[model samples]
Target: MRHLSPGELIDAAEGHAAARATAHTEACEACRRQVASLREALAALRDVPDDEPSPLAWDLLAARIGRAVREAGAPKPWWAAWGWRFAPLLMVAVLAATAGVGVTLWHQRAASGSAASAGAVPGADEALAQDADGDERAAEDPSWSLVSDLSAGISLDDAADVGGLPPLGGSERALWQLSSDERRTLASILEAELAESAAAAPIIPGV
Candidate 1:
């Protein structure tokens, strides 16, 4: 007796040719056993439900895909679109701050310069007054020729001393010794000298 092949048994179990295979299985013991095995395998396969996705699962998948597509197509915000809009404003703010700082520094520098010039004024004025007095004395006296005498015997130490007075000490001392009028005059001369000196002095960069 010829036994049914496993493939034929499987086809028979699936009811592909139910009547003909049923007859073959009942007559042949080997074919009957093969059919039974095939039937068991088919029963196992049937026990597992079909893996086709449910309608709810399909909707969830569609929603996720739709969200991804929408995100990909969405336009950027206005700020992102025109990022350079604030750049000029930022630059202006920076420049304004810098200018304010520069103006403040300039005013402070001017005030400092004014103070320094004020301090130096008296000494310069006293020196000028002494020179003028020497000139006047020389002019009035034939015996005391100011230019020749100043050129001949006057050293820096002697020149530093004016009139019948002792050497002018520091600015403070000179100012202390002078009358109010003399002090004022000395102050003006010192101011002028300081202005000249400030003009002549080369500016040192970066305090």
Candidate 2:
């Protein structure tokens, strides 16, 4: 009960059957049925009318396929899709970072200036003690007297306003013209005095 292969049956359906194949299909019911089915299917396909595409339809289809292929193959630009949307956010971030750095630098410089002023303050006090010609000049400026009073415990509010010293705004030229060593001494003394004050001050609980 050996049967012909499907390939042999298809060949027979196409009318290209070998003599042996034809004989086998004729003798075998299964082979003959398979061959008949293939023949009928093939005949139906052949009988169906060929649909010819119009020129415009082919052109449009080709254009769409070509566009799709080009889009898929082309490398996409990062900025093109997202740059405009995120550029402002990036700029704002950069600005914020720059401002923060600037503020930090300003604080550092102000601290250095304050430390320098604190050092210079004691020299001005010494100037007040000395019978120098600058005494009359120092007395002339209203701001000079405040520096002397800071040595005597004045309000912290006043110190904050004066920036840890009286407003030495180029009024008394001698006060401005302190030597480096004198400034260093003034700063050290001021630091020691401040430490003593902090030690003496009463601490409030739950602060």
Candidate 3:
């Protein structure tokens, strides 16, 4: 059997060694005696009291602790202020709300203008029906004759004639013939009427 080293004997004496070392030390007189002598010397050293610190040491320690506490309690820098931290977020929110309101107003104005224009147009429903009929006819016959007839101008005998060019009555007939304002007005009226019809149509369910 090998004898335990001084380090192992000291660890066993301090209750930190394995059980086998403890049992071997208990059964071995020489190892047990050496361990007891080391323990007694340590016990004697532990009985000595530590020396007291000088008066200046206590003052220095108190001042250091006070400075540490004061630094910890001081106010933060301007960059860490609450206003600076939240300003960007507030700006983004305000801009988003403004954009949303602007978009809503634009759409509302467009809708109102469309409604007013529709109210001004005469025979809008008839025009729409005629247009639909014309589209169907054109689709069925690629070589349509409607464009050629319009280009040739209408005759007084024709059903679609405007009664001999408004009877050549003063400047009003000339003004009516030369002015494109009527076409613009008619277009505005048609746009309004279409917008109204679209609004009145039944909504389809689901997205």
Candidate 4:
């Protein structure tokens, strides 16, 4: 016959075994010894009183529990984890928005200043428009038409005479004798001076 299990021995020792287990313990010497040992151990445990903690031990336990509960290990919100993932993108977007606002404000200020300047000067826009048109026309026509009053003493034929003019100055003759590279460099310098003068000159509406 197989030996009685620990559960069967426990049940027999506690007076709660089935009839078969009780009969097995009765017939088996080893099962009877096991049941007796288990009964004695259970009786010894029952004799001992339940332990209650001392006041200091209770206080220490409570403090340890409180420390754990009040600890600074606060978990981050659900969005906080995702925020780090997009931090660079968020920063870039913020910078782009700031730059856009700055540029828009700068343009608005520039336009307001231009409007104020135009308002302070009467016919300023018209004068500028006229000057631009005159420059375009001058560029298209290389020839200058003589005014009757300005050319009072000279005929059209005499105006065309090259010998009537004064001889070239030292600087003028030197410019005419410049090599191709030197001429290009000199032309660039003259163009720069002309541009500076044109920028500095004030526009007169009728002139």
lDDT of 1 by residue, 24-113 (tens): 888988887777787898799889998898779989999999999898787665443333433443344344445433443454445556
Candidate 1 lDDT at 9 equals 86
TM-score of each: 0.27, 0.31, 0.28, 0.31
Candidate 3 residue-wise lDDT, 76-175, digit = tens: 6543443343445334434444543344345445655675688843443333332333334333432223223332453545422322332212232232
Task: Looking at model 3, report the run of 10 residues with the lowest lDDT sum.
Answer: 159-168
Candidate 1 deviant stretches above 4 angstroms: 18-20, 50-55, 66-207
Model 2 residue 12 CA deviation (Å) reads 1.2
lDDT of each: 0.54, 0.58, 0.54, 0.55
RMSD (Å) of each candidate, 1 decimal: 38.1, 29.2, 32.0, 36.6
Q: What TM-score does prediction 4 earn? A: 0.31
Judge candidate 2 at residue 188 and give its lDDT: 57
Superposed model 3: Cα runs more than 4 Å off: 54-56, 61-207
State the displacement of the C-alpha of residue 171, model 4, in Å, after optimal TM-score superposition. 82
Please rank every candidate by lDDT, starting with the best: 2, 4, 3, 1
Q: Give the per-residue Cα lDDT of candidate 4 at 144.
A: 15
